[model samples]
Target: MMNGWIISAAAEIFWREENKMAEARSLEEIKLDYAWKFGCGRYIQQREALETLPEEIKRLGDKPLIIAGPRAWEATEGRIEKALREAGIEYVLSVYPDQNTYEKAREHASQAVSSGCDVIVGVGGGRIMDQAKASAYFAGEMTKARSGHFPVVQVPTSIATCAAFAPLSVMYTQEGASLGSLRHNFEVNAIVVDLDVIVKEPARYVASGILDGMAKMVEMQNGHDNITIEEFDVGLVTAFTLAKYTMETYRKRGVQAVEDVRAGKLTKEVEDITYLNIAVAGVISGCSKGFGQTALGHECYELIRTHFTQEAKDFIHGEIVAVGQSMQLSFNGQEDQIPALREMMNSFDMPLTLKDIGIEPTEENVETLYQDLYHSPFVKDCPEEAEKLRKAMKWLCE
Candidate 1:
């Protein structure tokens, strides 16, 4: 009787697995037909290939407008001007004071429009690239009929987030705040990644980026019920693989990678990090269309309405996400993983908690996040997961 029962139970388990696999496969077939293209292109050699600008700039437009963060004012404006001049491409420069704020992007866009810029050249970090994208779209709001105007050439200083290379850009109202919103503003016409510039970025930014890259893989394992991506099986698996490789690289390298980057020691391994940071991640975001499939471990946008003081919002973008990921892991009954994660973060001295980021888990913040968790877009796609998220958030707060 026991043998018979065990055989029946084993058969039932196999049947369930078959059913779930069928569902996952069914979900994979649904793809998005849209105007977007992404991949790694000639990133490591853009600067040295300056002599070829005349032809490349010509492909983008006759007149190009340059948008850069304040930090890149000296580096980009002078170098870009020299190149554009050599190429005989008309150009103007718009410098944004801050990198992460939508208001700053809006400000720069307003300025760029006033100057009658037809094409955009984004030079700086992801924020500056995002700003250029938003500026390009917002400027031609009235005239952007079907095909958008203003081709944007994205040049990222730090291979942090691939926002610069995607059709969508993440906008923030201020720093240390909630990710304001993800807007489908501009598409990348081309990307110019000078590895030298990438290596110069701070180690902390690179470390935080490792966490963001890992999130793509971790979240994909628990697929979402809604917002399905076409050919998601391929896309998800590819993204997962890429993210896994990057995370492993960072784990093995630690601060040595960061130090090497700062010292301009761009090795093959570091080069791979840049590709994951800028190339593969961007391609995943663009082609995968896996928007709502991956459940955000951090209660999405809950911190926006109540927590995120002005000072906190001003902190680094990836840092906030890093802390949020830890909180999310705790909710998943994966607290055991926290020590390993913390050790990795400590390598770059990356913030691993809300307290580390200069924010406290106050009752008010908890309540707001608790309430917001139910209505989050990702949560609505999978209610069961949302419930788990709530449980997780509540426990973490406790």
Candidate 2:
């Protein structure tokens, strides 16, 4: 009890001090810095990988806090629970309340701080992993332990996105609006990718993940000359390099892997493609350090959340973004790249346009889209850009 009290008081003091520092610091007085950091990214992609959990991971902490997706926890509990018990690791499990938002992350972080957990675990798909990272990061801030950064271990039950390995969280509001991406200062402690677990998830998740990973390369094309980090941007060049290879890998192996997933076959193609989407794409994001043009495909998805609010909720992030990718490319006069992308999206059953997202191509819908597009961040304040956006919306509605 005394220890807990002391820790709590210390956390309060640190929080107060942080606010004071923030208030005192000026924009010009601040000196920004970033480091190339890496974490223990492990891939245990096998039939019973969890059954043979790594020895290094067993001792991550004496007491751990786990934030899990309901389905994911149910699917992998027996295997992981037994392993944790065997290793004498005690864990507190909290089912994620079906949303990955900043509020939820802070709530879990408070739980971690109050529980005095030394390590954090996230089980399930993309949102689960992202929330885990966010919680761990916040836990560190709420507690002085671990130097304001708690280690996070991810157990991904689905290959839906790179959330498992990326040192970032794509946050959303309780109302389901895109809060955009939140990149963390630290990397993930590890990722336990059990093939046996991933094969059980819906095949669409794999396809969606591939389509999303494909955007890592294409979306980078936007905003190079727009709002971006200033200074030695060697990381940007390296990020693009890896993103190019990530796209190439996707082009070569994406279809076969999706088919393999659909068949529930644990083939080499599935493993490679899964890792590419998670690990490789994660590295690309890490290299970018959350800088450069972020407002393109994802921005379009946020716009959809507003325009097609109800229907947009039915589709996953990547599928909507796939539609946005086409719009993004088209808006930028990069229509030459649209055909092959659309073909691939169609093959994966991803939405090709706004109509594919279940909206009627009516006069009302077109006008609504035109108004939004004309004033969109990427299009507003420029007559030529507004015309481009109008044309793109017409094409998408068709």
Candidate 3:
């Protein structure tokens, strides 16, 4: 009986060791199963960057469809056509006349298909880029019927937004009202930014870009607590570093840069700020992923859109977001930062209060804006802060 009991004990120890080995193997398998998705364009930003487009185009295909807004086409059509002709690359130029709407995107996509273009090149500011990117995506969807997708290249004429580097595009109605966004599974194949062209753009566009970059940096910093450990990887690290650099650069030379650009003299500071706007800002935004924040200000833009006057309809995106940032700071109990932010905005002629953007600070308007904020996804991060935001809006009116 004693021998039998000892044998049973030995068998139990052997089974325990086997289970441990199996558990270790399972962990190894789990590690192997881990995957991550990251996307960004092959970015090229420099003076005369457009000169390299021919080589880039050859990599994709000889036949390219160039899409641009009216103004952008007017500014760079001669140079673009010259480059294509010099390279002996066959191409078709299409001007997207309407807003960045789904309908317009589909229209352009049909044009691309009928033109037998193998590549789509988007050139312009945020809206134009979004339209082109969406057009490429829709074109791909159409081609999926034939089992393929068209590659897209982006050439930004203005650094007003990161639409050039972003893997998604914001959609709007025909009248330029927000209708959320469309995300693509892939990034643009390449992005080319010609400093010469960008410098020639109005300083106001660059200023608006600065303000937008500032708002994004501030929001991400303010909401760092919301970032999970898994989300705080190299991407977040790079984003934070770039954001901090952008803020510092703007603080030191933002005013001078704007002045120089307005004077048609692209000083070193102007170039630096331009690069910050077009490249660094886009990188920071792209790398931020789940850790990024787009609350208060972004939501406010959508809420107050219908309230904009016809003249105010031309208001730049960053200007509105800058004001939204101030409102957010007020709600977040970071009021001390508002004065400096306001000073910066004032220096660049950015809007501050609701009245500045053509929105009357009436109780009805305030309530509508607040209700929109209340329903936003950001509220989940600060459920109790809605009252604070509401009170802040009242102070803004005052």
Ranked candidates (lDDT, high to low): 2, 3, 1
lDDT of the candidates, in the order given: 0.57, 0.71, 0.70
What is the Cα-based TM-score of model 2?
0.83
List model 1 lDDT by residue over 312-390, tens digit each: 6555656666666655565455667667876777777776555555556687765655565544433433667666766
Candidate 2: deviation at residue 167, Å? 2.0
Residues 1-398, model 3: lDDT tens digits: 01001123543354333222111111123111122223345778788888899888888877888988888877775888888899898888888766787777888889889989988899888988888778888898888834235788888898877788776676666676555556555667888888888878898888888888877656664434433446666665667667877888888888898888788886798778877886677667667542243556766665555334253586878877777887777766667878888898888887888788777877787776666666555553254565666666664564
Write down the TM-score of every candidate: 0.77, 0.83, 0.84
Q: Which residue pairs collide, candidate 1?
A: 30-230, 31-230, 175-313, 175-314, 176-312, 176-313, 176-314, 177-313
* Ordered list by TM-score, greatest first: 3, 2, 1
Q: In model 3, how large is the Cα lDDT of residue 164? A: 85
Q: Lowest lDDT 10-mer window, candidate 3?
A: 24-33
User: What's the distance in Å from true for residue 188, model 1?
Assistant: 0.7
> What digit string (tens of lDDT, one per residue) describes model 2 on residues 141-220?
88876556787888888887778887667666666655445566678877778888887778899999888888876677
